[model samples]
Target chain A: MSIYLDNGATSYPKPESVYVSIAEYMRNNGASPGRGNYSRAMEADRLVYMTRKALCKLLCVPRPGQIIFTCNATESINMALKGYLKPGDRVLTTSYEHNAVARPLKMLETDREIKIGLIPSTPDGVSDMEWYQQELSKGVRLVVVAHGSNVIGCVTPLDEIVSAAHRHNTPVLVDAAQTAGVYPVDVTSVPVDMLAFTGHKGLLGPTGTGGLYIREGLELSTLKEGGTGGMSLSPFQPSDPPDRYEAGTMNIFGIAGLNAAVQFLLDTGVEVIREHEIELAQFLMDGLDTVPGVTYYGPSSAKDRLGLVSFNLEGQDPNKVAIKLDRDYEIMVRAGIHCAPQAHHLLGTAPGGALRVSLGYFNQREDIERLIDALREITYS
Target chain B: MFLQSINVLDVDLCVQQPDKFVAHTRASADLREIMPYLNSMFRTSTYNHDAGSIKFTNDKIEYTIIGDKINIAKFINRTELHELLDWLKDLVNDTYDSRSEIIPMYVCRKPVPVLFIYNLLPKTNCQQCGEKSCMVFAAQLNKLEIDIEACPILSEPEYTANRRRLEGAFGAFS
Candidate 1:
């Protein structure tokens, strides 16, 4: 089998429970969650509710109702960004955000005349707290930053950023696309106003699964309005939590898969997965250090970043390396700007981009060894 | 010898029109020094400094140069193949003569991948290109399966730069 290393894009070989739950749900109870009151419908509702509960536990969100399911983090972010920002509102974000955050803000900047302040980060991809504080003092309506960069895999200082934003009575929205499952995101402790997460990546769920966690008192207008099973009589959208946000029929199968994946994470513990993934990444980075003509991007050490590394071979296009790796060695890695052009520009790998090797808990040391050997051959052969 | 002989070593065709072909040539000197020159000469060229190779396209013909060996693809006939080789020979000599004036670019000039291209796309996932996502459309573009004109979003003035870059990297719109 090919060695899968594009976990940052979307995790593969999802845990056995994820597949089982998805299949079982499809085979037995394939009813919409809130459409009916039959046994099958009730089962669907229980599944979605349990999925929400699982997410609340994983993300440290206070209430399960606050977890609003979306197609992916992109939709989650769009809901938060488009729903919250009005014309002329000031929004602050970091340089390391994916297009999920960047594109929405870019659109709003033009459509609504919302001012965007980009907080500069260190060379290692950590947000500059002083710059963030300065921006916060200017009284921005909201601050949205990625918890971890998809390109470099570096985790931002979300705690400090959130605390600083709170000091100025500004809300902070965290794009936790990269860190949600791999790292501990204690919303209760961090006081983050909003967080958007995807299930297909670190959470080990199927595709088309992700959600947004809105803080208790904060209200975001609905991005889409349609049939909510309960609010059929009213033409206006509901002013509640989950149903208000989820307009159409939910992706029950995806949520079932996510429920199982979250349970697996809860059972195994996130710290254990984090430690394993970090060890594998460290091994890959250490091996890369010996390869000639190889330049890695992001923080100097693996400890400071997520379980991934981005690098480029001298004179080789990242696509060429990735293609060779797949064709010659049956190894899989992602190569490109990683849907984060701003981040790549910050890492100085624009135009040609860079190759990314993202690690998952299932990745063993042997996988890293094989990757290192392949990279060595590609670089030095 | 300023230029020597070109030979078609092997041709492998999976379908009616061969998607890929391999060839080699004997030259007086190593082609490594002239790679960057070729890269600059071709809009669709990617030069790998570490591997000492350059891949570029002339019209519809894609060429990969390593030392004196050349692998080419997507030729309709022998005449087209010979014409491409002759053009390459001239490019090599011209670049060699003008080496003093030319600055060698060691960076890979490859087209940005589908994801990067997709980022620049409208990303409405509107499926106007007959594909589900803009990412899929970008992938087809990379494979030369489709052209930028197929994307309705490119017609918009807002995406003029993206259209230009795509045209530059892939070649003039088909």
Candidate 2:
């Protein structure tokens, strides 16, 4: 069996319930929510509402109605960035950010003339609090930071970041693509202004499912406007959210899958998953330490980062090594910049990226050992 | 059959149609206890269990019941108004008697599309509802701001078919 170690890109082999939920929704209740007064349509509306409530329980969100569904975390980040930022508004972001945050901010720089400031940090994804605090005093409109770095597998200290930004009366937007399902993200405890998450990743849902949680009273301009199945006569969009931000018929099929997936997370518990990941990550780190010619990036301890690693051989190119592993040993991993050039630049591995073996709930110790065995041969052969 | 009598509380000018009137009535029995039963009975209802209110449309009239206070909107005159109230009193008494047979659903049915209501309008832009156009009247109707009977044009003999359609879609025609 080919090892699937690319949970960072998109999770595969989703929970059976996720697949079943999507198929059931498509086959049985094929109706648009808020579009009609039919019983089936109302059922669809209940499914959506239940999913929102489930997410609120998971994220510790205060308001369920503010959670707006988007195609993916990228769309969510775009909604938060484009909708929240005014022309010429200043934003402070981190050095190791995914293209989701980088690309949109780049476009905003040119189009809206917004000044984008980068906060320096180490490869372990800990922000430079001294510099961050100094900049906060200078006054910025927004702070965008990744809750976890995809390239380095390091988790950022969100508690500190959110509190510092809030002290300055500035709102913080977090990209939780890498950490959401595997970590205990309590929005009530942290009180993040806005958070974007992908349903397909740690959430164990299908692709094309993700959402944004906007704190109560935090209004963002709508990115797109169309029929929300209610209030069709009014030319102006609804001032209240979920409706305000969400327009057009949603992917109820995918949302059905997400609802089941989140329910699974709630049932299994994220703390259980986190403990399992640490065991796998520490095992991989331990095995990698034994092999010669392997230089991995990120924190020394597994507890300090996500269940993934980015490593390079002494003389082998990351792409060739990944191809050899797949062709010869039936192993799969990600190579190249992984769509985060800023992260690669910070690690001094700018152009040629490292091999990324991101672990999933399905991954076991045997999978990591197999990966390690494959790397040992690839190093010598 | 708990609600034996429904006393008229007050009467006022319908906001959407000043020619028409909206009336408020106080039910003898607490109607809040049977809201969920009414919610399950009416498919096109917007029920707020927390607010203890259920708003629904029957025939061409709209009714919003909060606790024991009933706000009935859009009737041609006082004669038809009492007839509507009496119809409601009997309907509630019957529903309460049959509560054990029905499954009470707390989930509110989402709002009906204004466009659907607009399609049922006469499209005459006839300022008969005290509104500039029929579309605005349809929007107000969707929000429960005005009653369906506000558009007197729909009551005309020529528009009987449209009125029947409205009654069929919302509730049973009297």
Candidate 3:
């Protein structure tokens, strides 16, 4: 079988339960939730509700209604950005943000006259706390950051960032797109103002599924307004939590798959998954040490990062390396800027991106061995 | 209309289909003028004006344009390659000849952007069209995978202007 290692973009070979649940939902109850009173519709609503609750539990969120289902983390980030910021709002973000956060912020910079200050980050992908504090002291309205860098797989110190923002009375928005399902994120203890997540990556759900969790009493203006299967005659958007934010029909099919994936995570345990992934990543890194002319990015230790490694062979384009990996070794990996131009710029991997091999719970030690073996061959051959 | 040269610069394994090949070709001629018309004619064609590229499938062979180069993917053998080149030549010439009759569309006529299409649609997000949301329905419409008439709200008199725009944009593809 081919080795699938591009889990950062989207996890492949999802748990059997996720696939089975999606098919069963499509076949048995494909009705739109909250739109009808029929049995199938109610079942759809129940499934969606269960999925929300599972997400809340997984993220340590207090309320299920606070979680709004979105198409993907990009949509969730857009909603958070557009909904929260007003004209002339000063925002502080890190250098390691994905395009999801950067593009929306850039648009708001023009449309709302918001000022954005990017906190300089270290080469290891950690936010420079001194610079962040200096920026925060200058009185910013909001602070947004990515919990993990998708390019280098480095996990930022969210606790410090959140506390720093909270001390300044500025709310923090955490883009947990890379860390949500792979790492243990306790929002209850962290006290982030908002957290956005995607289900397709480490969560092992299908594409077109993701969510945003808003903290209690933090009101964001609705980004979209439509029928929420309630207050149809009111001619105004609902004033409730989820209904107010979720203005469109939910993706019940994707939610069904996500629910099963979350259930699998709960059963298998997040720590267990994290350990397995870290082990694989450590193995890959250790093996890479023996391979000459191969330079890797991210934290030196696997303990400081997620389950992925970004590297490039000497004088080889990342795309070419990835293509060779796929064609010759049947190993799939992601190349290019990975939608994080700022991070690439910070890492000095710009103009040519690095090849990324992201690990998952499903990955084994042999996969890393095969990848290292192939890289050694490529480097010498 | 004869070409000076068509050189296969590279052959890479196809991502979607592993067994198939993606041959990148460097052509001597600029193929921009015929792109929009081809987008209009082919149901599978998706053109991005901003990117100045068109992606389409003809005779089960996927062709993607980037500047003057073409990446013909998912082809089996030399026969398919010859057939695709001849077909492309004929299409380019035919489109050039009938330029007056065809409106050179810059955006994708087959699969228009869902958000752009959604703006013209009734923002109801009603599931009457058997789609979860009008956005999803718009995506389906752009792919020419679903009928615009499937949406019952579009038939209403209030949405006549929007329907007209949608029809003007996608009706020919249908």
Candidate 4:
């Protein structure tokens, strides 16, 4: 039987409820929300609202209306960046961000004449808070940081970072793509200005579903505006938010799946899932240590990092090792940069990336054991 | 658990107010058993024991429950309608749960007759309430089909006593 391990990119074999909800919505309720006041359309409308409500409960957001739906975390990051940043604004970010945050800020740097500064971090991925405090004092309009690095798998010290930025009267936007579903992302406690997340990763929802939570009283420009299912008479878009940010027909299908996924997360507490992932990540990391010619990246302990780990083999291309594990052992894992060049640059693996085996809520010790066995065999081969 | 869902049967543009919407929905339960309880809980409710019907207003939206059907009018949009439905469903379920504790009112609040209302009206076919004529408005008002506030002329100093009489007969004020 083939084993799926590439959960960091997109979770596989989603919770059965997620699949069932999508099919049920598509087969039974195919009507568009806000298109008409018909029963079915109203059902779709409630379905969308319930999705937002579920996400709010899952993410610990106080209001459902503050969460704006997008196609993915990339769109969320783009929206948060493009809408909030004005011309010649200064943005401070982590060195370990995925391209979702990097590319948009780069585009803004060119188009809007904004400036970007990377927070100084230690070799293992912890941010230099002293340097960060000095930078915050120097004044930045916004601070964007990844809650967890997709490349190295280290969980950033968000409390320290967010507290420092807010002290400086600067708002912070978090790209929580990797940490949202697995970690306790309580906006109530931490009070992040904006938090962007994806549905298909730890959230265990279908692709094309994600959202951004904008704190109350914080309004951002619309990334794109069209039919928002309401207020058609006004030629100009409504001043109220999520409608202000969310325009055009939403992906109700994906949202239905996401609703179920978020409900699953709420039912099965993220704390329980966090404990499980930590155990699995530790097992995988500890197992890799036994195999000669294998070297892993990120923190030594699993508790300090995410459920994913990246590593390399001596004198072997990561792509071929990934392919061999897939073809010969029926094991699936991702290889290469994983689309965060800056993270790879930090790890001194700029061009060539490492083998990444990310765990899921459903992953077991047997799966990691089998992966270890495959790697031990490949070490000699 | 007593009221699980609301099945919306028909949705139409509210005639009294064109910009808003009206929905004809059937609750999972007949809600006949809970009407008295609802009548007890809602101060604004007008319960008619003889007709097995109850009408109430919440957040300026009118709800008339007869048998299993609940007609809701003057809602802004589908989202608000759904929220109202959920609110109503919760209210029904909550009232059903504590039903034994609530005292049921078996009395019918009197419905003002149509001609009586027509006599108080300016008797002009004002059509101010978007109705065709005063008689139609009075008939609609008698059925609780439209709010008494729909008639602007009724507010004038010429009809203060009539307006008070109408409000008293309806047991209501917008």
Candidate 5:
């Protein structure tokens, strides 16, 4: 079996429950939900509804329907960005946004004539809230910030940022692609307009399933108008929480798997999972620091970041190191741009970025040692 | 209603009003079935399917056909673009490949032609992956975004000097 380390991309060896539950759903209650009145269809609807409720409990959203599903966090982000912004509306975002968020905003910058102001993050990937407050003073309509940077894994001050945005009457859109399941996102207490997330990343769901939590009554122009099963009779799309934004048949299998995944998190308890992953990250961080010629990024302490690390070896091409780790060592790691060029640029890993070793709960101390041992050999040789 | 204009095999489909275009679902097979009718709408000559891209110069739109599975067509005028999107959606339902969804064709302005940059050195640079000229290999590599593993020569220590310099020239993380 491949030593899978790309948890930042998608978690592997997903809970057996995830696979079994999806199969169970497809085998027993496979049908277009909300379109039919049959028992199987109702069962499918119940499964989807339970999934939403599970996500709500995980994110602390009071209402379940406010959670809208999409193919991935990128699509959810695109929906939030495109739906909310009107021409000339000023959106304040941080420099640390993923290409998923940055690319859509850039497209809008070029074509839609929307004004984008960036709140530059510090070297450790924390946004300069003073800069954000300054932008808010300049009439910022929406403030989009990542709960954590995917490249460096630095967790931002979400509570403070959300509180600040609320003062300006600007609703913040938190891109929780990295932090959703690993970190506690209590939407009930934290003031945010929307929390865009992916099920595949920390949530441990299959790929091609993700979603957004739009605060009730927040309006967005529907990115795609389609048949949302329930309101098939209407000419215009239904103006409801999920159906308003979620247009089309959902990724049923992926969602069923995701429901199981989220259920796994609840059963295990996120606090325990978070504590374990953080400890593992700390273990790896401490191990990586002892190696000579190794330059790491993100907060020096593991307390400030997520379960991922980005570092580079002296006089080593990240790609070469990645190849060596994969082929010779059987250790899998990501090399090159982690899709957040601006963050790397800020961290001075620009142009040629660092090798990223993102750890998950399933990762053990022995795995960390193997990585450490491999780095020693790769760096020395 | 989620179907939109899809440019397929050199065809502009479902031309309609700006706001009415629908998003195409991956399930739709009808979009893939009308390729013959869609291909007939082409105004260009160089129908090089192997090049992996279809060019529509008059309208400044390029539809890069990613393999036989996915077709991403560009629309220049944002107005009535939905109509074209709708047509494309119909074709996608008809012609889509079974195994893959093919990367969605994103509408972009800059012609980021994947040009390969190689070390312009005359030295044999003969580090083994077999090609006599590193420049030719770079050109071929640039033309096709293949994995660096395919280029056998880069594995050698002799080409080490050129590989470092060459990867820097072609910036998106060599």
Candidate 6:
């Protein structure tokens, strides 16, 4: 049996209802959303709208129309970065952000004239809030921070960071790639201006589904131009919230699965899901800590981590360890830069990166025991 | 010298007359048998033994297969060519995989050839070239065989270090 430990990349064996709803949508109502008001097309539109509404409720944002569906977090980030930043403005981000955040910023640096400053994080994945504040003081227009570190799995203190950035009169865009569905991300309490999330990871949705939550009053230009469902009489896309950003036809089947995913999370509750995953992470960390020649990086305890652990063993390349785990024990883990070369650089895991074992709600206690046992075997061998 | 060199050229694959597989659904077991047909129809001219080696390694099995212009030529003649094309279509339909997306071939120009033209211009990424990245401009230059006179950064002493670095990175694509 293969034990999957790479949920940070994408979740596998998504909730049963999610799969069923996607199939049903494709079979029964697979039409271009908002393109026509026919029964099937309207059904598609409603399904996608429900997903936006669910995201609004889940994140405690003010309006459902503010949630714009995107192909993934990368696309969402691109839309936000390109749509928001103009030439000569400054953007503040953390050193611990994933490549989804870093790559877009780098591309923007080349295309648009902007000053981007990195708020450095400690080796344990904790960004110094004071350092973030200092960078925000430099007339920053937008602050893009990750809700959780994809490589190390530490959930940053977003409430404090958002409040600090707000003091500087800058809008904060949180990349909740790992935290959105697993934890209670109350936009009301956190006071964030925008939150970008991937639906396939913790949300248990199909791939090609993600959204950007833009709080009211944050006006961003649209990246793509095309026909929106409403206001056909107007030649240009409406300057409203989502239709302004979402130009092409929405992914109806994907939105159906996303809606089902949100329902599953709401039923079980985000807090319960977070507790289950954190317990698994703690279990794995404790076992790995006890073993000889194993070195785990991140928050020493699981209290600060979401559900991910990055580690390396003595005299063993993380790539080699990952291969051994797969070939011998059928245990899957990701090894290498994890697409966040800067994050790995900050944690001293650059060039050749560390072994990342990220957990999900589906991971059982026995899975944790199996991983520990396999590590013991490799260490002894 | 070319034999000693390893080039990681970007490859774009396509099945000529793909309308045949519009309705085809099954896949052929011998995937290699279908490569030649594609090469012949796609205007592939050169064939190299060491050039088109496709290796999949997992620290076990170490499966090694080679597919060059010649193999793609043979692929065009297989009895199961339709089935092979059908498998590719099915793969695309079932999963949103970019691996199945065909990207055009791009060979990074060698530094020696590039410098002959680059020597005339300032080798800067100052957006004076109207390109976002200098490396991207270099790739475009290779495609057009055009000289690099538009760059503003190359004239500056501060960008002297970057010019050499870009040359080394683009040198591998050759």
Better of 1 and 4 by TM-score: 4
Q: Write one digit per residue (lDDT tens) for candidate 2, span A1-381.
A: 988999988887788999899999999999987666565775676688778889989999865676889999999999999999999999999988999999999999999999999998887777789999999999999999999899999887888999999999999999999998998898899989999999999999989999999998889988999886554556877667787888899999999999999999999999999999999999999999877888899998999989989999888899999999899988899999999999999998879988998999889899999999988988777
Q: What DockQ does each candidate score versus the true complex, computed on alpha carbons?
A: 0.00, 0.03, 0.01, 0.22, 0.01, 0.01
Clashing pairs in 1: A315-B49
Candidates 3 and 4 compared: the better one by lDDT is 4
How many collisions per candidate? 1, 0, 1, 0, 34, 17
lDDT of 5 by residue, A1-381 (tens): 457677887777688999998899878778875555455665566577778889988998876777898999999999999988878889888887899989998899877888988888777887777778888888877888899988888888888888888888989998999988888888888868899999988898999999999997788888999986543445988665677777788888999999999999998888887888788888988898888988888887777888898899988888899999999989899998989898888888888898998877688888889889989987777
Score every model by TM-score.
Answer: 0.68, 0.72, 0.68, 0.80, 0.68, 0.68
DockQ of prediction 2: 0.03
**Which runs in model 5 stand beyond 4 Å of their true positions?**
B1-174
| lDDT agreement with native, every candidate | 0.82, 0.87, 0.84, 0.88, 0.72, 0.71
Q: Please tell me which predicted candidate would have the highest lDDT against the true structure.
A: 4
Which pairs in model 2 have colliding backbones? none
User: Which has the better lDDT: candidate 2, or candidate 5?
Assistant: 2
In the predicted model 4, the residue pairs found to clash are: none
> Which candidate has the top score in TM-score?
4
Cα error, residue A138 of model 4, in Å, equals 3.3
C-alpha positional error of residue A116 in candidate 1 after TM-score superposition, expressed in Å: 1.0
Model 3, which residues run further than 4 Å from truth?
Answer: B1-174
lDDT of 3 by residue, A252-369 (tens): 8999999999999988989999988878888999998999988888898898899988888888888998999999999999999999998889888997989999998888998888
CAPRI level of candidate 5: incorrect
